[model samples]
Target chain A: MNRDGARSSIDVLERYSGETYGRALLGVYLAAPTVWLVSMYAGHAAAGFAAFLVIFAFGLAMDLALRRSSVVLYDERYERISRKASDAVFNVYGGGGFVVFVSLIALEFLGYYEMTPRVETLFLAWSAFVLSWGVCYTAFKSRA
Target chain B: MKNRLPELREREGISQAELAEAVDVTRQTINSIERERYDPSLELAFELATYFDATVEDIFLYEADEDGV
Candidate 1:
């Protein structure tokens, strides 16, 4: 038995996991739109802006619904599930950014692409790298 | 990883908030450990064990089966 045995009678409070989940919602919102915009303006206007907006709105609603309550931890397993999902996104985004950056550099060297003043590609690549590593530690390291 | 933090904490009759203050962590962090949702760094684990006047093994247990890795 441990000291907390006395307080054991106190029911565990379930805080909503969606507060963190809200971030994922925000990530998808940002990522999808940005990608769509890049593709459209870069040369795919066939992808209607209205269509992306509708899909983004639906995701926003889903995110809100998921984050409505704070009981993210129904049990240890639920925490694990959320952690894994979050980590997966972070890792993918991070690794993908690096690959894209290197490819972009190669393209530029070959005169296959031109640099745009409005888009600091290197900075975005760096941001994604740092963010992904941070999420990796926060999410996976917790399980350690 | 598994821990007996809640059990040790209860023996002192201190709330998670109080334990967190003593150990310099957030209450949520303490709760996360108690619920086995998160594992503290070795330094933090040692701090908790020391604060509780117990060995690390006395406070936290390692279960290979549950290893997230």
Candidate 2:
């Protein structure tokens, strides 16, 4: 392998350290405290602790299973492809955000619905952002 | 931007992945160049030329637009 490849591989090795569960340890700890604080602020102080435990365990399990499995060989071509994807993602978020904003305003005016600072709404928003970026990245990568 | 990247790779009897490893790039980059879907940057073009023991022009044939784009 070339010097860059070796360096990148070393980076991957360091990030995961081959102890899969160990990679998730910090995430698991952080998730509990963050979720507990959010839940407690939302008037579910006691429930937060229970939810925290579940989330902590879930994060560890899921991250151990899924994260750091593949080490991507990034190069100039990958960078070029991803730049196109990033441009597309920017457009998607810019245009899509405007549409969503207008739609929400219209819905509120029509008294059909109200956007709230709830977990589900937050998740949905996150899902839209994630899916748009994912789709753009995949499409550009495949096109190339 | 048209190139003989695939032909050169074939002449070398190596996989795109192998060349990519040799040059510290991803196989998809090579595939993209071979397919004419992406153009390589000057640095990469030089690297590829160096790897193939050829000048950049030997691998790539560039035809400018009518308006010289």
Q: lDDT for each of the candidates?
A: 0.68, 0.75
Model 1 root mean square deviation, Cα atoms: 12.9
TM-score, candidate 1, is: 0.41
Top-DockQ candidate index: 2
Each prediction's RMSD over C-alphas, in Å, is 12.9, 11.4
lDDT of 2 by residue, B1-69 (tens): 899888999999999867876776666677788889889899989999999999999999999999999
After superposition, which runs of candidate 2 have C-alpha atoms over 4 Å from their true positions?
A1-72, A99-144
Q: In model 1, how large is the Cα lDDT of residue A142?
A: 93
CA shift at B59, candidate 2, in angstroms? 1.2
Please provide, for model 1 over A71-106, each residue's C-alpha lDDT reduced to its tens digit, 9 standing for 90 to 100: 331233345557799779866876676687778778
